[model samples]
Target: MVKGIIAYIVTDGNGQDAVKFYEDALDAQVLSLQTFGDMPENPEHPTPPEAKDRVLHAHLRVGENELMLSDTFPGSSLKLGDQVGIAVMISTPEKTKDVFGKLSIDGLVTMELQQTFWSPLYGQVQDKFGVTWQVSTLTQDE
Candidate 1:
Protein backbone atom coordinates (compact mmCIF):
# COMPACT_ATOMS: atom_id res chain seq x y z
CA MET A 1 0.00 0.00 0.00
CA VAL A 2 1.13 3.53 -0.63
CA LYS A 3 1.48 5.62 2.47
CA GLY A 4 1.96 9.18 1.30
CA ILE A 5 3.76 11.49 -1.09
CA ILE A 6 5.86 14.52 -0.32
CA ALA A 7 7.44 17.27 -2.35
CA TYR A 8 11.19 16.87 -2.32
CA ILE A 9 13.35 19.87 -2.99
CA VAL A 10 16.86 19.35 -4.22
CA THR A 11 19.49 21.98 -3.67
CA ASP A 12 22.87 22.00 -5.29
CA GLY A 13 24.65 22.72 -2.01
CA ASN A 14 22.42 25.16 -0.16
CA GLY A 15 20.24 22.73 1.77
CA GLN A 16 21.10 24.21 5.12
CA ASP A 17 20.36 27.70 3.91
CA ALA A 18 17.17 26.53 2.29
CA VAL A 19 16.03 24.83 5.47
CA LYS A 20 16.62 28.00 7.41
CA PHE A 21 14.79 30.05 4.85
CA TYR A 22 11.78 27.78 4.91
CA GLU A 23 11.75 27.62 8.67
CA ASP A 24 11.51 31.36 8.90
CA ALA A 25 9.33 32.00 5.87
CA LEU A 26 6.89 29.15 6.34
CA ASP A 27 7.31 28.51 10.03
CA ALA A 28 8.10 24.93 9.21
CA GLN A 29 9.03 22.57 12.00
CA VAL A 30 11.90 20.29 11.14
CA LEU A 31 10.87 16.76 11.99
CA SER A 32 14.24 15.25 11.21
CA LEU A 33 17.47 16.12 9.47
CA GLN A 34 20.31 13.91 8.37
CA THR A 35 23.54 14.86 6.69
CA PHE A 36 25.93 13.01 4.46
CA GLY A 37 28.32 12.83 7.36
CA ASP A 38 25.78 10.75 9.26
CA MET A 39 25.82 7.93 6.74
CA PRO A 40 27.57 4.72 7.59
CA GLU A 41 30.99 4.24 6.06
CA ASN A 42 31.21 2.02 3.04
CA PRO A 43 34.46 0.94 1.40
CA GLU A 44 32.96 1.14 -2.07
CA HIS A 45 31.68 4.71 -1.76
CA PRO A 46 32.69 7.36 0.70
CA THR A 47 31.13 10.73 1.47
CA PRO A 48 33.30 13.58 0.32
CA PRO A 49 34.70 15.68 3.15
CA GLU A 50 33.28 18.83 1.61
CA ALA A 51 29.84 17.29 1.32
CA LYS A 52 29.74 16.07 4.90
CA ASP A 53 27.72 18.99 6.11
CA ARG A 54 25.29 18.89 3.20
CA VAL A 55 21.84 17.55 4.01
CA LEU A 56 21.22 14.03 2.84
CA HIS A 57 17.58 14.35 3.87
CA ALA A 58 15.39 16.66 5.89
CA HIS A 59 11.73 16.35 6.77
CA LEU A 60 9.81 19.43 7.72
CA ARG A 61 6.21 20.05 8.68
CA VAL A 62 4.86 23.13 7.03
CA GLY A 63 1.54 23.94 8.64
CA GLU A 64 -0.02 20.50 8.34
CA ASN A 65 1.72 19.37 5.17
CA GLU A 66 5.13 17.79 4.80
CA LEU A 67 8.12 19.04 2.85
CA MET A 68 11.37 17.26 2.28
CA LEU A 69 14.73 18.64 1.22
CA SER A 70 18.10 17.31 0.24
CA ASP A 71 21.36 18.33 -1.32
CA THR A 72 22.53 16.72 -4.51
CA PHE A 73 25.41 14.32 -4.29
CA PRO A 74 28.77 16.00 -4.57
CA GLY A 75 29.73 16.97 -8.12
CA SER A 76 26.08 16.95 -9.29
CA SER A 77 24.09 20.06 -10.05
CA LEU A 78 20.41 20.81 -10.50
CA LYS A 79 19.18 23.37 -12.94
CA LEU A 80 16.53 25.64 -11.41
CA GLY A 81 13.56 23.87 -12.99
CA ASP A 82 14.83 20.42 -12.00
CA GLN A 83 15.11 21.12 -8.31
CA VAL A 84 11.83 19.52 -7.31
CA GLY A 85 10.60 15.95 -7.32
CA ILE A 86 7.87 13.75 -5.81
CA ALA A 87 8.62 11.12 -3.23
CA VAL A 88 6.28 8.16 -2.81
CA MET A 89 6.23 6.41 0.51
CA ILE A 90 5.09 2.83 0.26
CA SER A 91 4.06 0.47 3.01
CA THR A 92 5.59 -2.73 1.71
CA PRO A 93 8.37 -3.95 -0.56
CA GLU A 94 5.85 -5.62 -2.86
CA LYS A 95 3.83 -2.43 -3.23
CA THR A 96 7.03 -0.47 -3.75
CA LYS A 97 8.11 -2.81 -6.54
CA ASP A 98 4.70 -2.63 -8.17
CA VAL A 99 4.61 1.12 -8.08
CA PHE A 100 8.20 1.43 -9.26
CA GLY A 101 7.55 -0.88 -12.20
CA LYS A 102 4.51 1.12 -13.28
CA LEU A 103 6.34 4.39 -12.97
CA SER A 104 9.26 3.12 -15.05
CA ILE A 105 7.14 2.22 -18.03
CA ASP A 106 8.28 4.35 -20.97
CA GLY A 107 10.14 6.34 -18.36
CA LEU A 108 13.79 6.68 -17.51
CA VAL A 109 15.06 4.84 -14.50
CA THR A 110 17.58 7.05 -12.77
CA MET A 111 18.35 4.54 -10.04
CA GLU A 112 17.39 0.91 -10.10
CA LEU A 113 15.44 -0.26 -7.07
CA GLN A 114 17.87 -1.52 -4.48
CA GLN A 115 18.64 -1.56 -0.81
CA THR A 116 20.53 1.33 0.71
CA PHE A 117 21.51 2.48 4.15
CA TRP A 118 18.31 4.47 4.32
CA SER A 119 15.75 2.21 2.70
CA PRO A 120 15.24 -1.48 2.21
CA LEU A 121 13.81 -0.77 -1.23
CA TYR A 122 14.28 2.48 -3.06
CA GLY A 123 14.64 3.82 -6.58
CA GLN A 124 14.27 6.93 -8.71
CA VAL A 125 12.44 7.30 -11.99
CA GLN A 126 11.38 10.07 -14.30
CA ASP A 127 7.95 9.24 -15.66
CA LYS A 128 6.71 9.87 -19.18
CA PHE A 129 5.46 13.28 -18.14
CA GLY A 130 8.97 14.21 -17.01
CA VAL A 131 8.05 14.06 -13.36
CA THR A 132 10.66 12.50 -11.14
CA TRP A 133 9.59 10.06 -8.44
CA GLN A 134 11.54 8.59 -5.59
CA VAL A 135 9.87 5.37 -4.46
CA SER A 136 10.81 4.06 -1.07
CA THR A 137 9.45 1.62 1.48
CA LEU A 138 8.95 3.16 4.87
CA THR A 139 11.10 1.94 7.70
CA GLN A 140 10.09 1.96 11.31
CA ASP A 141 12.44 4.83 11.98
CA GLU A 142 10.76 7.03 9.41
Candidate 2:
Protein backbone atom coordinates (compact mmCIF):
# COMPACT_ATOMS: atom_id res chain seq x y z
CA MET A 1 0.00 0.00 0.00
CA VAL A 2 0.96 3.63 -0.47
CA LYS A 3 2.45 4.64 2.88
CA GLY A 4 3.44 8.22 2.28
CA ILE A 5 2.44 11.37 0.47
CA ILE A 6 5.10 11.92 -2.15
CA ALA A 7 3.58 14.80 -4.18
CA TYR A 8 0.44 16.23 -5.70
CA ILE A 9 -0.53 17.11 -9.25
CA VAL A 10 -0.57 20.88 -9.68
CA THR A 11 -0.03 22.10 -13.20
CA ASP A 12 1.67 20.20 -15.99
CA GLY A 13 2.39 22.79 -18.64
CA ASN A 14 5.23 23.75 -20.94
CA GLY A 15 6.51 25.53 -17.80
CA GLN A 16 8.49 28.05 -19.83
CA ASP A 17 7.94 31.09 -17.57
CA ALA A 18 6.21 29.28 -14.70
CA VAL A 19 9.32 28.88 -12.56
CA LYS A 20 10.01 32.61 -12.46
CA PHE A 21 6.36 33.51 -12.05
CA TYR A 22 5.88 31.16 -9.11
CA GLU A 23 9.09 32.25 -7.45
CA ASP A 24 8.06 35.90 -7.61
CA ALA A 25 4.34 35.72 -7.00
CA LEU A 26 4.30 33.12 -4.25
CA ASP A 27 7.65 34.10 -2.72
CA ALA A 28 8.56 30.47 -3.02
CA GLN A 29 12.12 29.30 -2.46
CA VAL A 30 13.45 26.84 -5.00
CA LEU A 31 14.83 23.96 -2.96
CA SER A 32 16.14 21.89 -5.85
CA LEU A 33 16.45 23.09 -9.41
CA GLN A 34 17.72 20.42 -11.77
CA THR A 35 17.74 20.06 -15.52
CA PHE A 36 17.67 17.20 -17.95
CA GLY A 37 21.36 17.54 -18.75
CA ASP A 38 22.24 17.12 -15.08
CA MET A 39 20.94 13.55 -14.96
CA PRO A 40 23.84 11.31 -16.06
CA GLU A 41 22.07 7.99 -15.55
CA ASN A 42 19.68 8.57 -18.44
CA PRO A 43 22.17 8.94 -21.29
CA GLU A 44 19.78 7.34 -23.76
CA HIS A 45 17.17 10.07 -23.16
CA PRO A 46 18.87 12.20 -25.85
CA THR A 47 18.28 15.62 -24.33
CA PRO A 48 19.58 18.42 -26.51
CA PRO A 49 22.17 20.78 -25.04
CA GLU A 50 19.83 23.75 -25.38
CA ALA A 51 16.99 21.89 -23.71
CA LYS A 52 19.21 21.24 -20.73
CA ASP A 53 18.36 24.72 -19.49
CA ARG A 54 14.75 23.65 -19.16
CA VAL A 55 13.58 22.67 -15.69
CA LEU A 56 13.66 18.93 -15.04
CA HIS A 57 12.68 19.09 -11.35
CA ALA A 58 11.99 22.11 -9.15
CA HIS A 59 10.80 22.08 -5.55
CA LEU A 60 9.16 25.29 -4.35
CA ARG A 61 8.34 25.99 -0.73
CA VAL A 62 4.99 27.78 -0.32
CA GLY A 63 4.01 28.35 3.28
CA GLU A 64 3.71 24.87 4.79
CA ASN A 65 3.49 22.99 1.51
CA GLU A 66 6.14 22.11 -1.01
CA LEU A 67 4.98 22.64 -4.56
CA MET A 68 6.83 20.96 -7.40
CA LEU A 69 7.16 22.15 -10.98
CA SER A 70 8.74 20.59 -14.00
CA ASP A 71 8.73 20.69 -17.77
CA THR A 72 7.59 17.77 -19.91
CA PHE A 73 10.37 16.13 -21.88
CA PRO A 74 10.65 16.42 -25.64
CA GLY A 75 8.08 14.32 -27.55
CA SER A 76 5.96 13.88 -24.40
CA SER A 77 2.33 14.81 -24.83
CA LEU A 78 0.61 16.20 -21.72
CA LYS A 79 -2.15 18.53 -22.77
CA LEU A 80 -4.53 20.51 -20.58
CA GLY A 81 -8.26 20.02 -20.79
CA ASP A 82 -11.46 20.31 -18.78
CA GLN A 83 -11.24 16.72 -17.61
CA VAL A 84 -7.83 17.35 -16.09
CA GLY A 85 -7.21 19.82 -13.27
CA ILE A 86 -4.70 20.41 -10.47
CA ALA A 87 -6.26 18.86 -7.38
CA VAL A 88 -5.68 20.63 -4.06
CA MET A 89 -6.90 18.53 -1.16
CA ILE A 90 -7.21 20.33 2.13
CA SER A 91 -7.76 18.83 5.55
CA THR A 92 -10.77 20.94 6.48
CA PRO A 93 -13.89 21.78 4.54
CA GLU A 94 -13.87 25.42 5.68
CA LYS A 95 -10.42 26.08 4.27
CA THR A 96 -11.10 24.06 1.18
CA LYS A 97 -14.32 25.93 0.47
CA ASP A 98 -12.71 29.25 1.18
CA VAL A 99 -9.87 28.51 -1.21
CA PHE A 100 -12.30 27.37 -3.84
CA GLY A 101 -14.25 30.59 -3.55
CA LYS A 102 -11.14 32.75 -3.57
CA LEU A 103 -9.73 31.02 -6.62
CA SER A 104 -13.07 31.33 -8.41
CA ILE A 105 -13.06 35.12 -8.38
CA ASP A 106 -11.72 35.50 -11.89
CA GLY A 107 -12.02 31.79 -12.58
CA LEU A 108 -14.72 29.42 -13.73
CA VAL A 109 -16.61 27.13 -11.39
CA THR A 110 -17.20 23.77 -12.94
CA MET A 111 -18.61 22.21 -9.78
CA GLU A 112 -20.04 23.70 -6.62
CA LEU A 113 -19.45 22.62 -3.06
CA GLN A 114 -21.06 19.30 -2.27
CA GLN A 115 -20.45 16.13 -0.35
CA THR A 116 -18.63 13.51 -2.32
CA PHE A 117 -18.85 9.79 -1.77
CA TRP A 118 -15.17 9.79 -0.94
CA SER A 119 -14.74 13.22 0.64
CA PRO A 120 -16.75 15.52 2.89
CA LEU A 121 -16.62 18.57 0.64
CA TYR A 122 -15.73 18.74 -3.04
CA GLY A 123 -15.54 21.47 -5.63
CA GLN A 124 -13.83 22.21 -8.94
CA VAL A 125 -12.76 25.42 -10.59
CA GLN A 126 -10.43 26.85 -13.19
CA ASP A 127 -8.23 29.74 -12.17
CA LYS A 128 -7.86 32.98 -14.09
CA PHE A 129 -4.64 31.77 -15.66
CA GLY A 130 -6.30 28.75 -17.28
CA VAL A 131 -5.17 26.36 -14.58
CA THR A 132 -7.84 23.95 -13.37
CA TRP A 133 -8.20 23.16 -9.66
CA GLN A 134 -10.10 20.60 -7.63
CA VAL A 135 -10.60 21.35 -3.97
CA SER A 136 -11.57 18.51 -1.66
CA THR A 137 -11.72 17.70 2.03
CA LEU A 138 -10.85 14.10 2.69
CA THR A 139 -13.00 12.34 5.25
CA GLN A 140 -11.81 9.91 7.87
CA ASP A 141 -13.60 7.09 6.17
CA GLU A 142 -11.72 7.74 2.97
Candidate 3:
Protein backbone atom coordinates (compact mmCIF):
# COMPACT_ATOMS: atom_id res chain seq x y z
CA MET A 1 0.00 0.00 0.00
CA VAL A 2 1.12 3.53 -0.72
CA LYS A 3 1.27 5.56 2.44
CA GLY A 4 1.99 9.04 1.14
CA ILE A 5 4.09 11.13 -1.18
CA ILE A 6 6.45 13.73 0.21
CA ALA A 7 8.33 16.57 -1.33
CA TYR A 8 12.01 16.10 -0.65
CA ILE A 9 14.35 19.04 -0.91
CA VAL A 10 18.05 18.44 -1.33
CA THR A 11 20.62 21.11 -0.67
CA ASP A 12 24.16 21.24 -1.84
CA GLY A 13 25.70 21.60 1.63
CA ASN A 14 23.52 24.04 3.57
CA GLY A 15 20.53 21.89 4.49
CA GLN A 16 20.59 23.16 8.06
CA ASP A 17 20.19 26.71 6.84
CA ALA A 18 17.34 25.67 4.58
CA VAL A 19 15.63 23.91 7.45
CA LYS A 20 15.80 27.05 9.53
CA PHE A 21 14.51 29.11 6.64
CA TYR A 22 11.52 26.83 6.18
CA GLU A 23 10.87 26.75 9.89
CA ASP A 24 10.52 30.53 9.94
CA ALA A 25 9.15 31.17 6.49
CA LEU A 26 6.67 28.32 6.11
CA ASP A 27 6.17 27.54 9.79
CA ALA A 28 7.25 23.96 9.28
CA GLN A 29 7.67 21.80 12.38
CA VAL A 30 10.72 19.61 12.30
CA LEU A 31 10.04 16.09 13.48
CA SER A 32 13.58 14.76 13.18
CA LEU A 33 16.94 15.79 11.83
CA GLN A 34 19.98 13.61 11.36
CA THR A 35 23.36 14.64 10.05
CA PHE A 36 25.74 12.48 8.08
CA GLY A 37 27.89 12.34 11.20
CA ASP A 38 25.00 10.69 12.99
CA MET A 39 25.19 7.65 10.75
CA PRO A 40 26.77 4.51 12.12
CA GLU A 41 30.47 4.39 11.32
CA ASN A 42 31.08 2.19 8.32
CA PRO A 43 34.78 1.47 7.94
CA GLU A 44 34.32 0.72 4.26
CA HIS A 45 32.67 4.06 3.46
CA PRO A 46 33.60 6.87 5.77
CA THR A 47 31.67 10.11 5.87
CA PRO A 48 33.75 12.84 4.36
CA PRO A 49 34.85 15.56 6.75
CA GLU A 50 33.15 18.18 4.61
CA ALA A 51 29.84 16.29 4.77
CA LYS A 52 29.87 15.39 8.45
CA ASP A 53 27.83 18.47 9.30
CA ARG A 54 25.51 18.11 6.32
CA VAL A 55 22.01 16.84 6.80
CA LEU A 56 21.58 13.18 5.96
CA HIS A 57 17.83 13.40 6.54
CA ALA A 58 15.28 15.76 8.02
CA HIS A 59 11.54 15.24 8.40
CA LEU A 60 9.21 18.16 8.84
CA ARG A 61 5.47 18.66 8.94
CA VAL A 62 3.78 21.47 7.10
CA GLY A 63 0.02 21.63 7.08
CA GLU A 64 -1.14 18.05 6.47
CA ASN A 65 1.77 16.93 4.35
CA GLU A 66 5.35 15.93 5.00
CA LEU A 67 8.42 17.83 3.88
CA MET A 68 11.82 16.17 3.83
CA LEU A 69 15.25 17.62 3.35
CA SER A 70 18.78 16.38 2.94
CA ASP A 71 22.16 17.40 1.62
CA THR A 72 24.16 15.74 -1.09
CA PHE A 73 27.39 14.11 -0.03
CA PRO A 74 30.47 16.14 -0.78
CA GLY A 75 31.49 16.01 -4.45
CA SER A 76 28.19 14.45 -5.53
CA SER A 77 26.83 15.04 -9.00
CA LEU A 78 23.53 16.52 -7.84
CA LYS A 79 22.83 19.82 -9.56
CA LEU A 80 20.84 22.72 -8.12
CA GLY A 81 17.74 22.27 -10.25
CA ASP A 82 17.67 18.53 -9.68
CA GLN A 83 17.73 18.86 -5.94
CA VAL A 84 13.96 18.52 -5.59
CA GLY A 85 12.41 15.06 -5.75
CA ILE A 86 9.36 13.12 -4.66
CA ALA A 87 9.44 10.41 -2.04
CA VAL A 88 6.88 7.62 -2.24
CA MET A 89 6.36 5.97 1.09
CA ILE A 90 5.09 2.43 0.89
CA SER A 91 3.55 0.22 3.54
CA THR A 92 5.57 -2.96 2.91
CA PRO A 93 8.84 -4.02 1.40
CA GLU A 94 7.07 -6.18 -1.13
CA LYS A 95 4.91 -3.29 -2.34
CA THR A 96 7.92 -1.02 -2.38
CA LYS A 97 9.81 -3.42 -4.61
CA ASP A 98 6.86 -3.65 -6.97
CA VAL A 99 6.56 0.08 -7.27
CA PHE A 100 10.30 0.58 -7.59
CA GLY A 101 10.59 -2.01 -10.31
CA LYS A 102 7.71 -0.51 -12.28
CA LEU A 103 9.15 2.97 -11.93
CA SER A 104 12.54 1.82 -13.17
CA ILE A 105 11.25 0.23 -16.36
CA ASP A 106 12.14 3.08 -18.72
CA GLY A 107 13.65 5.35 -16.11
CA LEU A 108 17.10 5.49 -14.69
CA VAL A 109 17.67 3.59 -11.51
CA THR A 110 19.96 5.70 -9.39
CA MET A 111 19.88 3.31 -6.47
CA GLU A 112 18.64 -0.25 -6.58
CA LEU A 113 16.09 -1.24 -3.97
CA GLN A 114 17.88 -2.50 -0.91
CA GLN A 115 17.78 -2.41 2.85
CA THR A 116 19.24 0.66 4.47
CA PHE A 117 19.69 1.98 7.97
CA TRP A 118 16.49 3.98 7.70
CA SER A 119 14.29 1.60 5.75
CA PRO A 120 13.78 -2.05 4.91
CA LEU A 121 13.51 -1.21 1.23
CA TYR A 122 14.81 1.97 -0.33
CA GLY A 123 15.79 3.10 -3.79
CA GLN A 124 15.82 6.06 -6.16
CA VAL A 125 14.80 6.39 -9.80
CA GLN A 126 14.33 9.11 -12.35
CA ASP A 127 11.22 8.56 -14.41
CA LYS A 128 11.04 8.88 -18.17
CA PHE A 129 9.69 12.37 -17.66
CA GLY A 130 12.80 13.24 -15.67
CA VAL A 131 11.19 13.47 -12.26
CA THR A 132 13.20 11.73 -9.59
CA TRP A 133 11.45 9.49 -7.09
CA GLN A 134 12.62 7.90 -3.87
CA VAL A 135 10.67 4.77 -3.06
CA SER A 136 10.88 3.22 0.36
CA THR A 137 8.94 1.31 2.96
CA LEU A 138 7.85 3.34 5.96
CA THR A 139 9.79 2.83 9.16
CA GLN A 140 8.14 2.24 12.53
CA ASP A 141 8.51 5.85 13.51
CA GLU A 142 7.09 7.13 10.28
Candidate 4:
Protein backbone atom coordinates (compact mmCIF):
# COMPACT_ATOMS: atom_id res chain seq x y z
CA MET A 1 0.00 0.00 0.00
CA VAL A 2 1.18 3.48 -0.74
CA LYS A 3 1.27 5.81 2.25
CA GLY A 4 2.66 8.96 0.72
CA ILE A 5 4.57 10.36 -2.19
CA ILE A 6 7.39 12.91 -1.94
CA ALA A 7 8.98 15.01 -4.63
CA TYR A 8 12.67 14.42 -4.88
CA ILE A 9 15.06 16.57 -6.92
CA VAL A 10 18.43 15.59 -8.27
CA THR A 11 20.97 18.24 -9.18
CA ASP A 12 24.34 17.94 -10.80
CA GLY A 13 26.10 19.47 -7.79
CA ASN A 14 23.77 22.18 -6.56
CA GLY A 15 21.32 20.20 -4.48
CA GLN A 16 22.40 21.93 -1.32
CA ASP A 17 22.17 25.34 -2.93
CA ALA A 18 18.72 24.52 -4.26
CA VAL A 19 17.60 23.68 -0.73
CA LYS A 20 18.76 27.09 0.41
CA PHE A 21 16.95 28.75 -2.46
CA TYR A 22 13.69 27.02 -1.63
CA GLU A 23 14.11 28.02 2.00
CA ASP A 24 14.50 31.67 1.13
CA ALA A 25 12.06 31.87 -1.75
CA LEU A 26 9.21 29.64 -0.63
CA ASP A 27 9.85 29.75 3.10
CA ALA A 28 10.54 26.02 3.00
CA GLN A 29 11.77 24.69 6.33
CA VAL A 30 14.91 22.65 5.93
CA LEU A 31 14.58 19.43 7.91
CA SER A 32 17.90 17.77 7.31
CA LEU A 33 20.99 18.15 5.19
CA GLN A 34 23.51 15.36 4.83
CA THR A 35 26.60 15.54 2.69
CA PHE A 36 28.53 12.74 1.05
CA GLY A 37 31.29 13.47 3.54
CA ASP A 38 28.92 12.65 6.36
CA MET A 39 28.67 9.03 5.38
CA PRO A 40 30.66 6.69 7.56
CA GLU A 41 33.79 5.26 6.03
CA ASN A 42 33.58 1.62 5.10
CA PRO A 43 36.32 -0.62 3.76
CA GLU A 44 33.95 -2.17 1.20
CA HIS A 45 32.31 1.08 0.08
CA PRO A 46 34.57 4.00 -0.73
CA THR A 47 33.52 7.64 -1.07
CA PRO A 48 35.08 9.72 -3.79
CA PRO A 49 36.90 12.94 -2.92
CA GLU A 50 35.08 14.96 -5.54
CA ALA A 51 31.69 13.86 -4.16
CA LYS A 52 32.53 14.81 -0.60
CA ASP A 53 30.97 18.23 -0.93
CA ARG A 54 27.90 17.06 -2.78
CA VAL A 55 24.59 16.64 -1.03
CA LEU A 56 23.87 13.04 0.00
CA HIS A 57 20.32 13.80 1.06
CA ALA A 58 18.21 16.76 2.15
CA HIS A 59 14.67 17.14 3.39
CA LEU A 60 12.43 20.20 3.50
CA ARG A 61 8.94 21.15 4.57
CA VAL A 62 7.06 23.55 2.34
CA GLY A 63 3.80 24.51 3.97
CA GLU A 64 1.96 21.18 4.36
CA ASN A 65 4.11 19.38 1.83
CA GLU A 66 7.54 17.82 1.99
CA LEU A 67 10.37 17.49 -0.51
CA MET A 68 13.45 15.31 -0.68
CA LEU A 69 16.59 16.16 -2.59
CA SER A 70 20.07 14.99 -3.38
CA ASP A 71 22.84 15.51 -5.86
CA THR A 72 22.80 13.01 -8.69
CA PHE A 73 24.97 10.19 -7.40
CA PRO A 74 28.47 10.07 -8.75
CA GLY A 75 28.44 9.24 -12.48
CA SER A 76 24.67 9.63 -12.80
CA SER A 77 23.30 12.47 -14.91
CA LEU A 78 20.78 14.99 -13.65
CA LYS A 79 18.28 16.13 -16.24
CA LEU A 80 16.38 19.36 -15.71
CA GLY A 81 13.19 20.65 -17.39
CA ASP A 82 10.59 18.61 -19.32
CA GLN A 83 10.46 16.05 -16.53
CA VAL A 84 8.05 16.84 -13.71
CA GLY A 85 6.10 19.83 -12.47
CA ILE A 86 5.01 20.59 -8.91
CA ALA A 87 1.50 21.84 -8.32
CA VAL A 88 0.92 23.96 -5.24
CA MET A 89 -2.46 24.88 -3.83
CA ILE A 90 -2.07 27.94 -1.68
CA SER A 91 -4.50 29.40 0.83
CA THR A 92 -4.96 32.90 -0.46
CA PRO A 93 -4.40 35.15 -3.44
CA GLU A 94 -1.88 37.27 -1.56
CA LYS A 95 0.19 34.23 -0.79
CA THR A 96 -0.04 33.15 -4.40
CA LYS A 97 1.20 36.55 -5.53
CA ASP A 98 4.01 36.59 -3.02
CA VAL A 99 5.15 33.11 -3.98
CA PHE A 100 4.87 33.84 -7.67
CA GLY A 101 6.81 37.06 -7.29
CA LYS A 102 9.64 35.34 -5.50
CA LEU A 103 9.87 32.29 -7.75
CA SER A 104 9.61 34.28 -10.98
CA ILE A 105 12.36 36.73 -10.06
CA ASP A 106 14.97 34.83 -12.04
CA GLY A 107 12.65 32.22 -13.55
CA LEU A 108 10.56 31.96 -16.68
CA VAL A 109 6.86 32.53 -16.25
CA THR A 110 4.95 30.10 -18.47
CA MET A 111 1.65 31.64 -17.44
CA GLU A 112 0.91 34.89 -15.70
CA LEU A 113 -1.00 34.72 -12.45
CA GLN A 114 -4.54 35.70 -13.16
CA GLN A 115 -8.15 34.79 -12.43
CA THR A 116 -9.23 31.58 -14.14
CA PHE A 117 -12.43 29.63 -14.42
CA TRP A 118 -11.12 26.89 -12.15
CA SER A 119 -9.11 29.02 -9.75
CA PRO A 120 -9.10 32.57 -8.50
CA LEU A 121 -5.38 32.80 -9.15
CA TYR A 122 -3.31 30.50 -11.31
CA GLY A 123 0.14 30.58 -12.79
CA GLN A 124 2.98 28.39 -14.02
CA VAL A 125 6.71 29.02 -13.82
CA GLN A 126 9.99 27.30 -14.21
CA ASP A 127 12.36 28.28 -11.43
CA LYS A 128 15.94 29.25 -11.96
CA PHE A 129 16.92 25.74 -10.93
CA GLY A 130 14.76 24.43 -13.78
CA VAL A 131 12.02 23.07 -11.51
CA THR A 132 8.57 23.72 -12.91
CA TRP A 133 5.66 24.78 -10.68
CA GLN A 134 1.97 25.38 -11.02
CA VAL A 135 0.81 27.77 -8.30
CA SER A 136 -2.88 28.23 -7.74
CA THR A 137 -5.36 29.67 -5.29
CA LEU A 138 -8.62 27.83 -5.59
CA THR A 139 -12.04 29.35 -6.13
CA GLN A 140 -15.17 29.05 -3.93
CA ASP A 141 -16.20 25.79 -5.51
CA GLU A 142 -12.97 24.12 -4.58
* Reference-based lDDT, each prediction: 0.94, 0.67, 0.92, 0.78
User: How high is the lDDT of residue 106 in model 4?
Assistant: 91
Off by over 4 Å in 4: 80-142
Write down the lDDT that model 2 would get: 0.67
lDDT of 2 by residue, 1-142 (tens): 1111224333344454776787799897877777766666555766777567666667678777777666666655566553234657677888887888898999899789898554698777779988777677867654
What would the per-residue lDDT of candidate 4 be over residues 1-142, giving only the tens digit for each residue? Answer: 1124467666788887888998999899998898988887777978988888899768799999888777866887656554345667777898889888898989999899998645798887889998777777856554
Q: Give per-model TM-scores.
A: 0.95, 0.47, 0.96, 0.54
Per-residue lDDT of 5 in model 3: 94
> What tens-digit string does per-residue lDDT give for candidate 3 at 14-103?
999999999889888999999999999999998888888999999999988789999998998787578899999999998998999889
The best candidate by lDDT is 1
Per-residue lDDT of candidate 1, residues 48-111 (tens digit):
8999999999999999899999999889878767799999999899999999999999999999
Sorting all predicted structures by TM-score, with the top scorer first, yields 3, 1, 4, 2
lDDT of 2 at 41: 50
Q: Ten-residue segment with the worst summed lDDT in candidate 2?
A: 1-10
Q: For this target, which candidate reaches the highest TM-score against the unseen true structure?
A: 3
Give the C-alpha lDDT of model 1. Answer: 0.94
Looking at model 1, the pairs that clash are none
